[model samples]
Target: MRFGGFKRLRRFSTSRRLWVALVLLALLAAVLLLQQRSEPPDEDSGNGYAGLGEDAMEYAQAEPSHSLQFPGDHGPHPDYRIEWWYLTANLEDENGEPLGIQWTLFRQALASPDDEDDDSDSPWSTDQLWMAHAALSTPQDHWFDERFARGRPGPDQQGQAGVTTEPFSAWLDDWQLMSRDRDSGDLDSLSVTARGIDDDNTFGYRLDLTAEGPLVLHGVDGFSQKTADGQGSFYYSQPFYRVEGQVEIDGEMRNVSGRAWLDREWSSQIMGPAQQGWDWFSLHLADGYKLMAFRLRGGGEDGGDYLSGSWISPDGNVTNLDDDAIELIPTEHSEIEDREIPTQWRLRLPGQDLDVTVKARHPDRWLDTVFPYWEGDVTVEGSHSGIGFLEMTGY
Candidate 1:
């Protein structure tokens, strides 16, 4: 969900990590062996071999030119290479103390783009893998956790990841985003819960989310183009969730409520070969509008990374923006996880006559996990006042 660290890997021995990694590799090898064994003797050449490589490239290059569909589109798109359901909340306890929570599920495809013959016989044959991250940050301390699982296509599997409309449940394993309604399926009242343990620290939460505003899609018609060549992902958000729930830390339950934002994005090829990482922002303004922005950091000769975002009005009107239409300037940097991260930022949108300053709620909110980075709550002001989350990866 949130790609941030390699810290956890240190706890395991080289032999143990290798053993686990080998198990996964062996599973993949077995699947490949089975596919080769099942191929018909003379039916191979006509099965689009010459076109396979080209088809894969074409699939990667095809313009994400279509508009996004809701309800139906919110479900999984196994055809894509990567996808994520990211949620962040800025909350206050019953005592009005500030707190933050994050839960995210990331999906990555292991097979090539053209490998689409449904290998449904074996549950382990799926080329998709799922990973999730959960975190809670208070003024005094920060706690985070992560999970990984192989994606299975059936209900028999415990670590399943999918979305449904009628009951409005979207989840991966015990970590979920589901409707609180006992009858109808709507985005009104929802529940989110995640649990995990690391070393001697154990953390998790069960919270209720009530939507105070409508869902908003980013970019034109939901096709969020990321690169100059028009490579992009479909993105959307629910930025006005009033949260009232409880978090369990070290077996202690604390009642809390705050604002939350939910982000859903899917793509076939997210990072190009030359892109190292990305920095993303999702802000909920005090006056009602929401802001979402991101910049992909291209490595080597790929030039500066691509940047884009959306300006959503209070009533749900979206103003899609391009790189030239907006600006994000890093003013200060701090060493986080052995990397320099800009904790202070200046944002300007000329067309909207807006300029704002952004800062992290705290510097220690850095999640030191499998894929680590800075993903914490932040405050924004100047032209607008807001509270939201700021994420920096591959720093």
Candidate 2:
């Protein structure tokens, strides 16, 4: 969607453009923070939030060396520059109508761990920025919204946005995803709530998710690789969730139930200089297996793509997948929000005896947020039948 006709729209303020950038690259918002530390107030650096130049040594980076710990790792890792708690549900309404929902909270540190103790007289000073995004898609229509906030990092959590490991809560304003059991680790049982407003009306959801299987870590025990040179993030997922909740849209509330996938990852930098974007997939097969795969465009082995994933058995055994084990190819395209997007894809895992074609229920599932992208529930056909979510970025 393009803004036109209004002269004021032609000269969107710097803050407005920043908000657009914040939504488009929410996970990489720390780049803006780093620039703020180096630039003057009146001057604007259009470099945006990405790329690690001189600051490479100033912050932490993901490696095959660091091991991920639960509960603590599930919370915030402020030492790293970027992290996000992402959730996507493949659900159905009481009438058996298909519905896809999403709720996410992103945290990007303005300062490295060493800068956390910087002298500041004001109690409201903060070194952390928070952002949230939520969306809902039915068979015929899609609704989405974005939010932003500022707060102090750890040891100071009395702000508008923060996460706690004890009760395990990640939130911004009234929107949050919290643990139902304080004593439970790995966030076994949890509740999620997020609300957003668009032109159509208000749409949001409150859902309960219970894990039926153990967590599946990506790459080498949660140390996911993004490029051949070893730049990546710590990635893992609770893909065996049995979700039951209520969805409220257009002032009407209805019950919903289905499967949900929870992703927790953090990194100083997930993209290299030549990388454009990525295509991520999370599918639940009919035979009780789960598949998580992604292709990092332009930032892979020998400047191609860093393709990798994880194959999770029904009993929770994980088989780490690299470029050799899987194949991801764009099969079809659709023009949405002025960009040609691959709404249909073909994925294969020869060892698992799985060869499937994934298709979006509708092409209109384009999320016209700060940076528009395609994220919607997908149906699998070919060797097996099931439902899942497909995310394609960098159009």
Whose lDDT is greatest here? 2
Residues 73-139, candidate 1, lDDT per residue (tens digit)? 6666666656787889998887887888999887766554455564769755666677777888888
Report lDDT (Cα) of residue 257, candidate 1. Answer: 83
Looking at model 1, report the run of 10 residues with the lowest lDDT sum: 46-55
lDDT score for candidate 1 against the true structure: 0.72
Index of the highest-TM-score prediction: 2
Candidate 1 runs further than 4 Å off: 1-7, 10-64, 116-120, 153-161, 182-186, 299-302
Model 2, 248-319: lDDT tens per residue?
989899899999999998877766656666788999999998899988776666658789898889998988
Question: What is the lDDT for 117 in model 1?
Answer: 62
Global CA lDDT of candidate 2, please?
0.78
TM-score of each: 0.83, 0.87
Question: Which residue pairs come into collision in candidate 1?
Answer: 3-371, 4-371, 4-372, 4-373, 5-370, 5-371, 5-372
